[model samples]
Target chain A: MKQRLSTLMAAAVMTAAFAVQAQQPMKKAPPPAKAAAPAKAKDGITAEFEKFREVLEEDNPAELFEAKGEDIWKHKKGPDGASMAQCDLGLGAGVVKGAYVQMPRYFADVGQVMDAERRIVHCMVKYLGYKEEDIRKQPFSNDSKTPDHVSVITYVAAQSRNMKIAVPQKHPKEIETFRIGREIFDYRAGPYDFSCATCHGSDGMRIRTQDLPNLRKPAEAIRAYQGWPGYRMTGGFMLTQQWRMNDCFRQQRFPEPAYLSDSITALLTYMTATANGQVYKGPGIKR
Target chain B: MTAMKTTILCAATLACGAALAEEVRDYRAEAIAMMKRDFKTRGIATADRVHEDGLQAICNRTSDHPPKAIAERLERDQMESIKYPPDGKLMGDWKAGEKLAQSGRGMTWSDKAGVPGGGNCYNCHQIGPQETSFGTIGPSLYQFGKLRGNTPDVQKYAYGKIYNAKAFNLCSAMPRFGHAGALTESQIKDLVALLLDPQSPVNSK
Candidate 1:
């Protein structure tokens, strides 16, 4: 009890100190024209990042997807004349704005919980009159081809940008999904015996230089979760949460979870639920 | 300010909620149900792997921290699980070790079963000075032998540690390369030499 009390006090003090330190200005640097050694030149990368955000915010590359996504969203195609405008994303049909943040919600029509991509697949099949096989054939995008689904989801997700994350847990099934998701988050399997918890279950845990988020923490989980469906500069393409989970499973030495798999849905349910109060701040940029 | 207030209010309500009480009581059973419903077997990776082993279950429950007595006991069990080479030799060619260390492949759904896998050491440790791109998850092995000379005991220690890291310390994030069969005994020996042999670049440079 005494040890626990001291630890609690220490944590409170540290939190206060961090809050104070965060408000202080980053160390001023000399002009980049005469920069020092690459390692020592930057005091805080925050200022450098600030510059990137200032310049890049004007013409976000995601705009390409958003533009293309909007086109794909309204266009009548997919073997029959139809548009995704009729598809309901848990906020009723044609309601794109703020819908993404409210998602992984129980859809009464489908009687299941779904993320943006799943809803998109449902819309493509139902309203757009495309087969699940044809739609799943190219859910992702590559340089050679921009899959209609990838851009469409990006546009839909962007509508909820800067909105509060409000994923519903009121439905009994939604609650059950959250419970199941937490389990999958902790489930350890694969050649390396890694669960998501192996890297993401703790604070200060990192793989290489990339700091893993402790998904159990709301603040960290929200910050991390909202930053996905990112524009991967390395791959030079947009990615959805499904792709992110798939790649992570690949890294875990686990089998591929088929596109829009239940495991991925459950994991997203757990993750986004942890992000309940964070402002949606993505289709983001990635290193 | 609104977000903070909302969070505090929710936390306060949840702190007194019966749901929170239920979660505390039934987290494990819920986890088992989740794995059964969601996980699927493919190739060498099976659904049963989602179910944690006894030691891993403890690690999961405690977030990789068990109480000292239980941890020590579990560590001993893990140590006992290690199967050293039949020849009792704990060193192999560091050249082969270096190649294995660099390649981060194998044991995934795509990897063929029984094929030798990479050590993937460089993914979490800096082994040789020549390799500039290396991970910082583990301590550097650059000059590992130069710092800690490779005696027979040291060689065996390296071999054993790589074989079953939890044997040395309970709840080590490092995988049990040999115990999990991700690497063979001979492969572990190669890795042992990669870290402990004088001629290895990890020591020479």
Candidate 2:
């Protein structure tokens, strides 16, 4: 009882601090002309941002969620009284090593290609007896709270650190899913006529100093794959690739995709397959 | 006998063409169907946003580079849609334009309806040198007025370009601010002044 109370109190204080930081605008820096070194590939600001990220990565808060997720994965508290230890993640039951890097793959039992988060949610629904709709109600974490599944995903992703991305292409369905994902990436609509391609289809593009990776290219595609299931510093929330895709649609001025839907899975398959053979650098810290 | 042989050859070629066409999967149609099934309209974002316009369909089909004749024809249609501000004034306050260029707000599911949208010019272009964090997706617009003399033609071009960038170049990465009902005519005029006004910081050394 005492431990729970202290944990709750710590969470409250952290949420307050995050709220304050969220409202504060980004600090303005001096013009680049004064600090401009002899022209290099990267500008001064991007270089500075990179150095800052390296410093932050040393003490990433995603570890907090990973610990919490590990706890949830072990405990058997659901209505079905089953732990997620036996959940099959495309590598047979009870197996977790390097599972994340090969996912968005065909699961014969479910007969659908499920990404890491989607398969995690599926396990939660099938083995743990949680209602899918209830889980979907607030799948993403916010300033005040982080979902259990989000933490689980963080924990799962950490297991695949330093592993090569090898999203499967053996299944005919897997190939079709990847093809559909590419089509979705290029499909343009909405108010701006913006597809994923509009911002990310080409190389050497930016949307205000922020580099937009061309996902079609393997070298740049790793930028999208790596550092996901990240701790976003601005909101102090642990987020997953699922949340990222949902937010992308929102920013694209399009309707929200149904949580853990096939479209998101297909999109992940496309991106992950393109990034095959690249190393994933575990849970990342985001600015 | 020669006529009969020619008829048989045509039939075989037609059969081969039909077989090749059938083998190709219509992944675009499947993707659209999946989106229709999986996406739910929320707030200001509606289901109709998934449906592509005719020009958008062409751009997607051709990878943003449609044929020359077709592109020119559609570009003219886009040009004819530009609505210049009343009172014969194409320039507004450059100060307002600067603010709009810096902002990246309005027009999402979260934004309230009827609020003014930002031009978001700096998100993809360098305008005033003071803001060093400008993007490189589009060409730099620094000294837009200094390089091009601020003639009536220049002012009109700036206004029209912001109003509907597709009018100038089809398949441009730049959005059509006015044509899409995103920015008001008055807002586009301010952006014009920001580009062409001599007193604006964009023109100043």
Candidate 3:
């Protein structure tokens, strides 16, 4: 299963948390029997992880990346001596406010539709004169390292906090992208024959103790929409929708999708559109 | 009715059928093309994994609920492909099965090619009394052997089910451990014991 590793890691983290707090025999330790626990303490374990998430949410490190992103956004340091401040994020030249919610839109200039991260990386290569290959080589933040553009996307997402999701479907290409995205969402392949829909298509389902949000339903879809470009507690760095999608494919045992590729944008468009009308709670923190 | 009136009625019915067929767009063809274009092979995760088999095509298109006739046909094909253990034994050590059930390892990009993968059963099913952290995606198997009586027929069914769950249920969420070459014949026999051995925690209180 895609979540099997995460399930084990979640159990270890919770165990360590309780171990530190109590400083004695583990209250939740297994009985004299040598068998491992599965569903007996499920509710208690979920609540513990939930409580830890709330505690970390209060002191999110995403703000640090956001502030760094703002500096890069305003400063001029490209081949043309240009700044991202002038890079239009679909609103006009340099309108960052509420732009994140309305993106993955038709950009007539590029002749393609792009999500928030894709558009930001495009500006980096186009306006800043950064090589496209160089950017894609190390797009995601790992360990203590956070890339400048990832921070930039985080900065843009923060600007649209509490804003409504409104990914556009006006252009024919935009509509077509959304349709392809919906198809990919349900497409099954690989050794396990799993799709994104396998875990997320149903309601009130879970793998181990982790709750799977039904991306097909808007009410549940918001859970998938919000809290992305998030600060990962385990990895301890910022990550965007592109990295998240890439990991989903990895877990599905499929070949790696190219960074900022059209397919990723289409999938993002589908997810963003399905989550339309739900409030984007800005950049989030995750376990 | 006159022959002319009957012909007109048949023509109208055919037109309606055509319209319905046209409305159901074959999005799979275009989507598969997109995947082939955008995805690149890396490590053990190859490009061929993106291509769908006949069974996956049906399950994906129908949302895992293909028509009974089609599902039954495909399931028969799957059943024929299962390679049972040569020794005629269908059960193994329950302790070994317990370890395999708890593990959810192998077959990802990071995994080595020749290494075996875990059954990952607890991730979907509630098995044994001690493991209260089991998933609810599949029905609970808390007392599988106690309920079923562990007959030879039941043991064969359990072994077959684990080897290739799709053969038993055409669109089952469980992986075909043997069919996919993820688990060895001995490993599957062990799993059968986990579900059907009377002395196993799954069967005993």
- Tell me the whole-model lDDT of each prediction, alpha carbons only: 0.73, 0.83, 0.82
Tens-place lDDT per residue, model 2, A1-287, is: 45654664465355446546545665556665432222223445456546756765655678778878878887756775777877999887867889999998999998889999999989878877878888888899997899888988998999999999989999989998999999999998888878998888898787776878999999998998889998876677898999899989988878889999999999999999999999999999765
What lDDT is reached at residue A170 by model 1? 97
* Interface DockQ of each model: 0.21, 0.51, 0.49
Off by over 4 Å in 2: A1-23, A30-52, B1-22
Q: If you assessed candidate 1 against the hidden native complex, which CAPRI class would it receive?
A: incorrect
Instruction: Residues A1-287, candidate 1: write the lDDT tens digits.
Output: 45644554453344344435545643344333221221212234444444654454444566567777888777766565657777889888788889888878888988888877898878877877767887667767665666767888889888888889999999987887788788778766555767887778776644533456788998888855665666644344678878788778877876556688666777788899898998888687543
TM-score of only chain B in every candidate structure: 0.87, 0.88, 0.86
- For model 3, how does the per-residue alpha-carbon lDDT over A1-287 read when each residue is reduced to its tens digit? 33644553454465345545544432453543533544345545457656876765555567777878888888757887887877989999889999999988999998999999999988877778878888877989887588888999999999999999998999988988888898999998898888898788898887877778889888888887789889776556788989899988988878899898888888888888888899998998765
Ranking by TM-score: 2, 3, 1
TM-score to true structure, per model: 0.77, 0.89, 0.88
Query: Which sequence of candidate numbers ranks them by lDDT, best first?
Result: 2, 3, 1
Q: Residue B2 in model 2: shift from native, Å?
A: 29
**Which is the winner by DockQ between candidate 2 and candidate 3?**
2
lDDT of 2 by residue, B1-205 (tens): 5445555565778575554443556889999999999988888788888888888888888888899999999999999988876688999999999999998776678877877878888888888867767777788898899899789899989989988888888888777888888898888889988999999888886
Chain A only, candidate 3, TM-score = 0.85
